[model samples]
Target: MDRIDTSVAHPARRYNYWLGGKDNFAADRASADAIAAAWPSAPVAARENRRFLGRAVRFLAAEAGVRQFLDIGTGLPTAGNTHEVAQAIAPSARVVYVDNDPMVMVHARALLTSAPEGATAYLEADLRDPGHILAHPDLRATLDLTRPVGLMLVAVLHFVHGEGAALPIVRQLLDALPPGSYLVASNATKDFLPPQIAAVYDRMLTAGQTDIWPRTRSEFGALFDGLDLVEPGVVAAHEWRPDEPDPSLTPADVSVYAAAGRVP
Candidate 1:
């Protein structure tokens, strides 16, 4: 595996730090701490994002009867990955995780293990190149585009800059999948955060790690134009149908949004 740079804080590493993992370097810890200081609920929001992933995966696997998943921009593996949650419900679920980050690719095999009945593979590709992902050997080997597949965009779409062009890329990926498929996602948002928090995050993005272009509820909803939104609509990650009534899991004030949609 290639040595990861510790000089600059990365979004994945900072998120790992927020989740109380030891995979982050000093730079990541420092940046996470600074953000946490400004937005005290930042760590909670991170945890909520993870929880939302778990909820969305389980819902798709159990309720929606989805067994194939294509998770794009999968960050550092934590507890309850897509395959882990999905396979727990249906042991035959197949998952293909895609990410351009070298560290994420390395960790995908090392940490995101699959159940014996199910299969998990990783694709070293970027979200900007949907064709590359579709043509990836690992993806083609694992996922069948003719079947109902779960397209997971998680917390990575915020890295896409400009008029949120990632939406069209998402459309291309979804266009290939069969009917009854789903798009599970969560992107960062500044609509609810304080000005200082947004300012610091903007600086962090300008530093060259990742970009965060937060949108309003309607703007976020625009990504799923042709898809049917699941219950509760686009809302905070914590507000997306909690399994248990979590009082501490109130709507996050941090700049993060999450939702899941199904293809009709």
Candidate 2:
């Protein structure tokens, strides 16, 4: 508890609040409200991103036959986690969850639950340091690098602000995996926002009032270079093989971009 800072608003806590979860503080709520003030459908986008995650996991476990998952930036425990989604299809599935948040480390017990035939492990690590995350003993113990693995970087990369920062980290992680592995990634984008709203977002971003770093479609697509993108190359969060139509939302509402690609 000493390491946890309640005065600051962290991305995971704010996301949990957006998802209508209770593991957040006043600061998180404030941050969420600030974002929502700019984009009124912020909560809808969060839920849509979660749904995209579930669909991507299902595609990997069921269609792609991936039995191992390395889910980075695994936020607060939700209904359909990587192991749960994969293990449902393959009981022998294994998962290694990595996150830098101390609160996530504290709630890792909820993430460690595994099917009797499967396994799950959690480690406190940052996405920016893929080397540490990949070389961590806990990660090595849970996942077999020799086999095809599903690398999940869902709804987390927007924090890596700058023109050419995130791609290098992504490339490094993908390089460590075998040829048959798959990469599932998504990031918040402002391409769908109207020019006026985008200007407001830009002002907030420049003033350091918001932490999310919105990227263009080309920037998001660059992360998948040297890999084979699955169907629907890159689309809005709710548009990627959606289980059902979300009539209440539109492309602008869910400004997050999502895609799944295979490492060749």
Candidate 3:
């Protein structure tokens, strides 16, 4: 494990803070608070993003019949994690979590637990390096590449700081999976945010605490170019198969776009 840096705020730690978790440093809390103060819906959007993860995993495990999952950019182990949700539906499910953060690696044990009949593993790898992630021994040991896999990109890709950097990575990972595989994603976007909220988020990037590149709806939709999108396609995170109605959460309040696509 690498040394944990408490001096700067990491994206995972700041996200944990926003989700009301205790495993974060002072710098993380400060950055999270600053974002929340500027965008009052930050915490709500975080929770909604988590909820989207749960719903998508459930659909994949139950309906899509995907037993193997590659959950990239998995942050701190929280409620309704990928393995927990999938294995709960199919006890024999296998899940591999990938993240480069050293702090996340330290907490990998929590995400490693699986049902007795199932398997789970964690890989400390960056998403940008798709080749490294695909070649990891733990990934190879846990999931069968020949079989269909649910490749989960969740709330991670927006961290890539270039215009065309994210989509190629998405394609690279998807290209590795079989035809029946699925891509589950939830990405942050500035399409529905106030101009001031965007400015404040930009300031955080300038501070070098953490960085994100929120995309437009069309840019996000382009990620699933060849795959067949699931019903209620490419909408706000909260609007994708909601379990119940929440009048409090409007489209603008859910600043993240979510979708699930199947490889034909």
Candidate 4:
């Protein structure tokens, strides 16, 4: 393990703060509060993203019959993590969580314990290096590349700002899995939101503490190329087959778009 620096405000730590977790530091809280002040729905959006993870994991395990998961950008572990949701439905599920954040790595090791029937492993890797993730010794030990693994990208890709963005990185990851593997992802979107909100968000992320890119629905959908999209296509994170009535949920409440697709 490594010593975590509490000096800078990291995206994952700040996200943990937004989700009401105590693993974050004062710097994280301050940045989160500042962002929340600019976009009041941020906290709610973080919660919805977590809910979406639960719902999607359940569907993938119980209905889609997926038993392997490779969750990239796994933030600081909190309640209802990917393995917990998947293995709850199917105890034999195997999950490999990847993240580059040192703070998240520390917390994940402490909090993300696997069930007896299932297995869990963590990789200190970056999403930018999908090759490293695919070749990680721990990942190879825990997951079977021949099987249908569920690939979870979640709200992590936008940090890859640029014209090409993280699309190539995504392709590299998706290319490794065997056929029938699933690609599940969510990304922040500027669609259906005020330009002012988007502008503020852009400025906040550009402060060099975090990476931010707001894509249109089509751009987000393009990430699933050569895969079969499940029902409802790419839509609002909360609307992508919500489980509970979450009266607090609204389309605009979350700026993220989520979807699941199966590789042909």
Give the number of the best model, judged by lDDT: 2
Which digits, one per residue and each the tens of the lDDT, describe model 1 over residues 7-123?
878778888988988888898888888767756777877888898999999899989999999998888888898898999999999999988777888888888888899899998
TM-score of each: 0.91, 0.98, 0.95, 0.94
Superposed Cα deviation of residue 122, candidate 3 (Å) = 0.6
Off by over 4 Å in 2: none
Residue lDDT tens for model 3, 38-155: 6677788889989999999999999989999999999998888999999899999999999888889779775468999999988889999999999989899999999999999988
Position 95, candidate 3: lDDT: 92
| Candidate 3 residue-wise lDDT at 217 | 90
Give the lDDT of residue 194 in candidate 4: 82
Off by over 4 Å in 4: 205-210, 245-248
Q: Write the per-residue lDDT of candidate 4 for residues 36-69, one digit (tens) a residue.
A: 7767777877888888888888989999899999
| Model 3 score (lDDT) | 0.88
User: Comparing 3 and 4 by lDDT, which wins?
Assistant: 3
As for TM-score, the candidate ahead, 2 or 3, is: 2
- List all candidate RMSDs to the true structure: 2.1, 1.0, 1.5, 1.7
Candidate 4 versus truth, CA RMSD in Å, comes to 1.7
Candidate 3 has a TM-score of 0.95
